[model samples]
Target: MNKHGLFQGGVAVVQPIDRGMTKMLDEQDDLYTVLLEGKLAGKKVQEHEIVESINETIRPYEDYQAYLDLAKNDAIQFIFSNTTEAGIAFDPQDTLTARPQNSYPGKLTALLYERFKLGKKGFQIIPCELINHNGNTLKEIVLKYAKLWDLGQNFVDWINTDNDFYATLVDRIVPGYPKDRATDLERAWGYHDKLIVKAEPFLIFVIEGNKKLEKLLPLKDAGLNVVVTDDMQPYRNRKVSLLNGPHTTMSPIARLAGIDTVGKVMQDKDFYKFINDEMYQEIIPTVALPKKELVAYAEGVKERFENPYVNHELSSIALNSISKFKARLLPTFKRYVATNHKLPQRITLALASYLKIYGGRADFEPQDTPEVLAAFKTLVQNDDYVTAALADAKLWGEDLTQYTGLVTLVKQDLQSLDQGGARQAVQQINQKGD
Candidate 1:
């Protein structure tokens, strides 16, 4: 909506009742500049320009009552949210009478209830949270809250029958506020914009819906990479396998090899080749989408990862890596095994590098839940640590030891990494033809 005049409406920018944050946004007049800094930067006439050319009003509101008032007046038609993965969860402690409900679902339920009282048409909800079936999950939790608060059967039926919750997968790399070059950017732009956000050229928004929804939004018609489909699983699989899988797989290896940002990893020939082979050879084949489409998306991912302006740190990507591995790479690892009846060498090596880093062998701290960290502490002490880690069903969600040759392969990779370091292990793999 910023770059192109896709929608013509007032955008209510709601913050979480933060007085200071709301004050800052108010001072800026709810205006922000998005610095296009990568491959797509050349497409635009100017590198730094307010893409909000359309005469759209952006009003910042921090109170829940303000949002409820918008709904009460039927000012809201579409709802979009990105409250993180944990945002759409249920909190039993949340009540209807609170100033604002604790969980995102709680707040949404209150808004829906207010709309219900007015007997207004339901809003088209599109949640950008990074979770499987995000829209459905959010709807379920909202209904749960309705029952908990005894909001009535009529309200529940209205929620189920009226509203359309779209499960969406959004892909973009927004490294906000180029602090290193902020002074220069501020001078060049001829203004000190506090809300400047830098981003890569790549973006894709996949919403699970039908042609009717496509007609409603028309984001695709506006030349944006927005796909409204009945089945979004294949697209989701492609993103998780190709984009996120590489991030999780390479971060530990790169960090262990003394590389910092993702750009530096792409600059290294061996690391780049490893990531490419992992995606094209191992990950892409497992996805249900067409090979050509997957390849195109993978190429875009490569360009985004190599964006010099975006300093995506390996340490940040390495946070909660255990869960990330399970969500991103483990499925590909299993799929490659089931499809080809063999181990994916690069992915296996990634798993081994994860163990090495979390086991305290590398010069980096592993950030994860306390339970995961504690489990790793004991598992690494065992002589057969690879077997122990793989056998711990609680860790990987299943007994990975059940898979034939996975244990032995991961152990061998761990041994190779321990003896010769990450670069040597990568070289050995590269020497062997894929």
Candidate 2:
């Protein structure tokens, strides 16, 4: 087995210490743990068999106590998680009394208590769950567990003084298991493992909190985008809005353009420029980051979309469309309209694209079949259909009913889409933006 992630497949023979320190580190979906150390060092390993086939003379992690001892006594640490928005939640029934504890946080608190058993203060924990303020949320849960179990003031002080919890945002298109090329991929790694973290060549980690981590974890030392700041809001906004906002709004449109994946869409001159222009002019101006950083971010986004190894399907990114719009795009739309005194044309086209796509499939499934999508789903292909779609307040998260002109604009774009297609609608919106 080529223990060093080095390969002769035309890629440079560089043995990445952390393989970009990502572990694909995606959270949406994955095959298994990507080992960065031990004998398997550079090779991607089967997540399930990773602990079972141990060549080293070390015991496998047994429970929360194992984590506690490792982090405290042996000075090892890990951020264990299921990596879903639904997974990083507080469990009402989970308690210190329960063996292994039902909730991830409760189990984690027990471990923290064990690690601080010696009464010293120094551990930095960064959670990667997709929840809002993931690290803070976990800390809140840990405290709740402490109170629930009557763990005493000493433990609470230890928690406050001795450890640091960081909020971090991880970005990468880690689509798991290249089933189509699993055999060949496995052959390249010299293994029969199927649990691999398949991802794009792109990676970005924004760690906002605790400079103490710089002393140990070398994510920043490696020149990764690991920012240690007192505020995570700007980073969150930049990623959710500028980096993802345009893509979220444009994916369905991309799919409808007869494009299968983001990589291909990036190559399509019209779609590519449409997305780039939207992010720069419409979305970027509305975000909180500086113009310079935003521009650089947009440039890199084009490369991420162009990563050849990543098969980032347009439809896959289109899931949870309603939530995505509300969380990612809706606020930006409001900001753009509020500050600029008018609606952003390209974004509205993306929204209108959603309605048109929702009423019926264009090339991708509607983001969701929620009431908003459902209402459009009912409209007949009559002249009033586009107008009818914009009246739903439930989807827009506000009474967009008042924005009649905006509605008219969206309708016009939708009409153009019906008459010409995505390219023409995009062109019309660009002209309108100008």
Score each candidate by Cα lDDT: 0.81, 0.64
Give the least accurate 10-residue stretch of model 2, judged by summed lDDT: 8-17
RMSD of each: 4.5, 9.5
Q: Write the per-residue lDDT of candidate 1 for residues 1-434, one digit (tens) a residue.
A: 43466666656655542332445555676677888777774353237666443222222233556666767656567888876554666889989887687677888898899899998999899999777789999999999999999999999999988899999998887667777888898898788777787877678899996467876777888888998889889879988888889998899887888888889989999999989888888988888888999998899889889888888778877777887788788889999999999889998899999988888888778987666899999998999888999889877889999999988988898889889989989888877836
Give the lDDT of residue 46 in candidate 2. Answer: 32
TM-score, prediction 1: 0.79
Q: Which segments of model 2 are wrong by more than 4 Å? A: 1-125, 129-132, 137-165, 215-225, 356-399, 402-404, 415-420, 431-433
Candidate 2 local lDDT, residue 431: 61
Residue pairs in steric clash, candidate 2? 121-162, 122-162
